[model samples]
Target: MPLPWDSQHFEISVGQIISPALTNSELENILSYAKEQGYHLIYWATCPDRMIPLPLLQSFSGSLVDRKVTYQRKLSTEFTFGEIKNPSHSFEVIEFPRSQANQQLKTLALIAGAHSRFHDDPCISKEKFAGMYHIWINRSTLHEIADVVFIVKNSANMEDCLGMVTGSVKNGIGKVGLMGVQKKVQGQGIGSLLMKTLHEWLISNGIHTSEVVTQKNNIRACKFYERFGYKLESLQHYYHFWVQL
Candidate 1:
């Protein structure tokens, strides 16, 4: 399952593929084809349960870059919206509108400082990484993939963004697409408040299950989600393969 349209670079989610194994020839052919099709940078994900032989992977000229854990939770019961008071009494959580793309892009740029794994990969520069997220948000707006986006704003000044949360639903399952709190508000409870609100929104929309993924090194994010009842589901190994054009 390669998600080429998700970003400027192509990403093959091997963990999602049920293939027993990718033979040397198959891997070569796939890489060759992707290169022929003008895919300069390619990456893939695999888990312990569906391990790719190290020898087979070593044959490629690419590099292993990141590891992530996927977390999931079932929405069996209704959730009561928890206390999400803004200490300044100036912030409010509101739906993100496509009209505010440019503004949100600025906010996201700041938020992404805490996020360094995928963006910090050798193959991705700061500009390219930001492009990846911009493309994702564009797809979300145009394709309804991530149809739900919420932002915490200062009521006194709507332009003052504190954090953001985004989600998408498909086939009765929901996914937290992205969540970030600005540097200034990281220590505050904004992240937790956003998660609780998103959970409540998912339940109200009849979603039966929801999931999210974060880098293994993101201890704060992992612990935060777990506190909200999201259980560890899978740990995935990530690799990036570069092709010369």
Candidate 2:
């Protein structure tokens, strides 16, 4: 599919291959079509069981950028919110107005996408990559992309946001759009508090399941979700193919 948002933002024509698997001949045809349409880059994602061969991909300049993992948790009847244990610092989780925390949230969004696929791809410039996250947070604050946003603040100094998480519910399932804890205060249980707050909000809205996706290389994120009872749902390999035209 044509990625108008990404293309317009990065000033390059971009598209994505929607098929899970493609033969060498099929890929050639797709690339031809992309070039004809003025596409400079194309993204393709494939499951492990249906991946295109490495040799064939290399022939077209397809570079692997990320191994995406999706984790899920069912909010079962036995599920309960555990108290956030923070011996080092006290925190206050609040559902602040989206407009109130736009700047702080945009900073956290940069941290969240620091090691993302866009950042890893050499085809994307640093400024453009940062701009991508900025646009994301801006849309999120407008409630166009995220339904609700939660931030954790130091109780003693409510002006400082230590962590933040954005969530949305659809079809009775909750999805975490972006989440991050400030670097200096990462291990202080602030992330856990933000997550707990999001879960409570989801459950109150009748959402019984939640899912999050992260890069496989982000071990800390994977472990964090696992600690919260989120199980592995699926894994996919992401590749960025830059046309030589």
Candidate 3:
């Protein structure tokens, strides 16, 4: 499938191989189609249990870029906030207007994607990654991509944002979009607080199940979700195939 948004944003013809299974002949046909369409890159994802042969992908110059992990859990009314170690540094979680906190939210968005797959991909420029996150946060604030955004702010200084989380509900299921804590405030239960706020918001909206995806290489993130009671739902291998002239 052609990714028009990505193609236009990155100034490259980009597409994704959505089919999980591919015969050798079908692979050749897909490559031919990409060339005919002047595609510069094609993305493909597969589960570990049903992956395409390494030699087959090697023939097409497909490079493994990320191991994506999906986590999920059912939201319940029986939820409690984790204890905050520093009562002196009190914080409050609130839903803030985008107009009031766009810049801070953008900063948090950059932090969220700092070590993401896009940042790790050598083919994707750093500038492009930054641009992508900026666009994402902007749209998310507009509710074009996400339903709501919550921020954890210092109680003493409302202007001080320690972390933020974005969530959306669809068909009784909630999904986390972007979440991050300021580097200076990380590991102080701020991330857990943001998640608590997110869970409350999701429950209020009648969403009982929530899901999130992260790079497997991000050990901290994986552990964080696991600690929060989210179980591994699926794991996928992502590849980027750059079409050669």
Candidate 4:
């Protein structure tokens, strides 16, 4: 079902539709109706284990956006803490202020790299990506939606933002929402320090398990989380359909 606030079109299928030919026609009709209603983009996701009708999917001129895998790390008393290295790259992680939403948005907009589907999609423009990033960072300000948000900054110059992480607690499980490092300092261990600090903070808040999701094609992100003891839990795929109206 499409959310009332969603502007894009969505269609979902479940429990085998038996007749492939009929299913394909129905899907085509749905797309036509969506186009008539001024929707240029559509999203469709299916059960990971179920057999997807390739002919039906290929019938549309859309692209595969992501193949994501979920990973979880369990905190234990035996866990060890490592030193956040790189003295030349001294930085601090501080709780983000709601008053500084614009500043945060600007920093995130400059992020040249992302592993997520939307950012990696060639069809999506940088302007659209920045708009999406703004919506994401501001979600934490909503009541009961996020527990904490921390931003990484240069210790020598506190106002200079480097990276940020958002987390939430649900049913006693801590989940990483969004985290990214600036492209200029990406490989200098900033991302590692950010996750390490976030893990410690989660543990102190009584969270025994932490989880994060990243596209399987994002090798760097997957490797980074695995180094922090996060194990793969599950995988899912999603398709993105775009048509010019």
Candidate 5:
């Protein structure tokens, strides 16, 4: 006598999870839809001799939206820290909210300060300096930290600006900009104090790294950072390129 057909062997095909109530054909369609729609799918190789679907948790960080919208810096830094020899000259560390649009003008002027120092060099003449500063204070500020401006001052106004550091905040990373003390004030302990404050702040806040960049020609700034303890992270030959895409 001929045996009746066994329905348990049938497969479903509608991209839906199968249950004991679902015929085998319906489960086949479900898997087909899942694959076509880019949904992840996995099942255990053995679970009491039966396969069980597993959950999938894919990362969104490397997706197109995340990758296309992010920017990374190519420069390295030499870290520094003060040994704290009595805290003789006291300084105040202040944090400002960069939320106010008007504050952006101050930010631009600060960038101008750095650019002005290099204006005479042919490699970064006045126009080039200004353009570079503009790009830094504008687009790049959105990447790292949220524009924290720290300054040291004393008798004789900001002329004794001692030192300054600025950068944007992102995901709690510290990417500092060395608006290094101008040509006049070189070894007045300003750089050390600034780095010390930065170190303390970064450590307290659980920031992972404090990175700053200085031109290879600027031996003074490079040495200054080295005295603090920042190691040479990397050597990169960077060129700025623009495209209207």
Candidate 6:
């Protein structure tokens, strides 16, 4: 028997249908159907949040699922803001207000990057991915905006000590996702510079607060977000499992 929100808790196998344009009613219908079939946990698409199918929750039938706080961070009503005034690195790229078309290209690129081979399906399929990529690229110019950043390179080459950080803006708040540097890139202030740039962009957009959800064991990431002015808001638990058509 599948858990209440099975599709969200585990990786989807072949034959499992995924949707990018599913409506609230449609998702509820599928979730309801999955519940009746003994499946638990489901994938959800949050569009303004980048349509990334982020496994952000463990949903279930009202009969079986309980919303529990596993990990969370709250935004202040009067959150302090910061801005990036100087740029010392040539690779620091930032985009603004998160254009739908431009973000589509970014998600596609991240899907194809060195780190996305395994989790690509959970995000989007290759065909749909390629299609979205072309659409966004055609509509998005290389205009340097003030709110987005790019750490892109020709390849994923890195020294043993360099670290990297990733983030996203949700409903105007900037949430830092993950950050680590390779040994070579560590201690050179790359991570801080990136952080500064992101915060600057946030302030410029009148976005002062930030939020993100991380697993319980990801202590490093949690601490990093705090250091960047994010306070713990709540804990969240997400379930995973597969569902038969």
lDDT of 6 by residue, 1-245 (tens): 23332233233322222654555466556666765755433443222222223331224322211122223344444544344223343344333233444433444333323232222344345655455434433333332222243342212332111233355566766765433344434444555555666666566677766555544344554565576665556543222223332
Q: Give stretches of model 4 more than 4 Å off.
A: 8-39, 47-55, 109-113, 141-144, 243-245
Specify the highest-TM-score model's number. 2
Residue 156 C-alpha lDDT in model 5: 35
Question: Per-residue alpha-carbon lDDT of model 4 for 1-245, expressed as tens digits?
Answer: 33443342122221112222334467667666655655556666544663446755565556668787899989875776466667677788787765436565456633623666667777677666666666667666442457777778898888677887778888999988777777777777777777777788888999989999888888888898898899999887666656442
lDDT scores of the candidates, listed in order: 0.67, 0.84, 0.85, 0.68, 0.42, 0.42
Each prediction's number of clashing residue pairs: 0, 0, 0, 0, 36, 43
Compared with the true structure, what per-residue lDDT tens digits does model 5 show for residues 200-243?
Answer: 66666666666765544456656666665556765432211110
- Candidate 6: C-alpha RMSD to true structure equals 11.1
Residue 115 displacement (Å), model 4: 2.7
lDDT for model 1: 0.67
State model 3's lDDT.
Answer: 0.85
As a whole number from 0 to 100, the lDDT of residue 47 in candidate 3 is 69
Supply the TM-score for candidate 1. 0.76
State each model's C-alpha RMSD to the native. 4.4, 1.9, 1.9, 4.9, 19.6, 11.1
lDDT of 3 by residue, 1-245 (tens): 99999999989998999986777678768977887778988987876665566766676677788899999999987865668757778889988675533778889999989767778879899999988998898888778888999889888899888899989887778999899899998988888888888898898888899999898988999999999899999998887887753
Clashing pairs in 3: none
On residues 1-245, what C-alpha lDDT tens digit does candidate 2 reach at each position? 99988889989888999997887789878977787777889998888665666766665678889999999998764665466666667788888686744677888998999779999998789899888998887777678888998888887898898888989987778999889888988887888888888888888889889999999999999998999999999999888888753
TM-score against truth, every candidate: 0.76, 0.93, 0.92, 0.78, 0.46, 0.42
Model 3, C-alpha of 18: deviation from truth (Å): 1.2
Looking at candidate 3, what is the lDDT of residue 128? 94
Q: Rank the candidates by TM-score, best first.
A: 2, 3, 4, 1, 5, 6
